[model samples]
Target chain A: SQKIEQNSEALNIQEGKTATLTCNYTNYSPAYLQWYRQDPGRGPVFLLLIRENEKEKRKERLKVTFDTTLKQSLFHITASQPADSATYLCALDILMDTGRRALTFGSGTRLQVQP
Target chain B: EPEVTQTPSHQVTQMGQEVILRCVPISNHLYFYWYRQILGQKVEFLVSFYNNEISEKSEIFDDQFSVERPDGSNFTLKIRSTKLEDSAMYFCASRYSPQSSYNEQFFGPGTRLTVL
Candidate 1:
């Protein structure tokens, strides 16, 4: 069975500091790894996706790095603010037999940006 | 930006009763999906629909579950008979054709189903 694990259950950091979250998986080599932001009681919003062949990807203040050899991904949110406080999820894209893609998610890491 | 929309933000049904969850996906999106998350648990994929047919389904999507695109816009998931374990937040998601962009999916505000 495939297993995905986020680094911690929750993280608290000060505003303007960088918050780094980790996601590790075992028993699978996914084609693409994605990150999503989920506020309490809301659906997850897509943040970024990095292909297995790509080492790192950036969008604004967010950066994601994929290390296939290590079966790990690191998600960084720099210049974090109180509004950035939310649960960050890591998901792997799975190709189904019918050629459609589905997502398998990890138990997300919740980040709380304190003032 | 067009986003997926789900009806009945919250639903409560008695055990053994049937419930239908409805979603209107983004107009131009071609792929549709259903996922559920129990309180404090990871979101789990239930099924994927494309071309008005089921493309893939997870083990949790057993005989009790069925999905249909009843019309051009509305996609539905029906639970034949709800069980206690059916309590969870159900989300509807859609994506544009893989050819156009990163197959990123847009999710709707979920429907919280409480089976008592």
Candidate 2:
């Protein structure tokens, strides 16, 4: 069985600061990992994805790093704003021996950027 | 930009009653998936449908759940004799073929199912 754990249940940071969230997994090696932003009462929106062979990927203000050796990925949002407050979820794409592929999500970390 | 859509944003049903959640995936997507998230919990995958048949399913998608692509644009999930534990927000997702660079699954708004 595979398991994923996020760093914290909630994080509070001042606006204009950088927010870093962690996602650690065990028992499985995924080919790719993705990050999503989920607002209250809404479905998750995809953000960034980093493949195992890649060390880092960035999109605008967001960046993601994948360390396959440590089975960990970090998500960072610089210059955070109150509007950036939302739950961040990390998901991994698992390809089974049966040729089935599924995305498994972690519990997620809620980030609050206050002014 | 195309997106997945689901109907009945919120549904309340009795413990023994049946409920059908509907979804219309992106027109060109070939892989469809069903997932559920209990309040305050992580989203859990239920089933995946491809080629008009079930390709994979999780243990949570037991005998009580069934999925169908009865029409060209509609995908549905039916829960027979729902239980209290079935209360959760059900989400429908779809994506292009795995070979495509845009393989990310697009999720619908989700139908909140509450079984009393």
| Candidate 2 lDDT by residue in tens digits, A1-115 | 6799999899999999999999999987888899999999899898998888999999999999999999999999999999999999999998866687789999999999999
**Residue by residue across A9-103, what tens digits does model 1's lDDT show?**
99999999999999999987789999999999999999999999999999999999999999999999999999999999999997766676679
Give the per-residue lDDT of model 1 (tens digit) for B1-116: 78899988999999999999999999999999999999999999999898889989998999999999989999999999999999999999998866656678899999999999
In candidate 1 the C-alpha lDDT for residue B85 amounts to 99
User: Using Cα atoms with residue i matched to residue i, what is each candidate's TM-score against the true structure?
Assistant: 0.97, 0.97
Model 1 chain A poorest 10 in a row by lDDT: A93-102
Clash pairs (backbone) in predicted model 2? none
Choose the strongest candidate by DockQ.
Answer: 2
To one decimal place, how large is model 2's interface RMSD in Å? Answer: 0.8
* Candidate 2 deviant stretches above 4 angstroms: B98-102
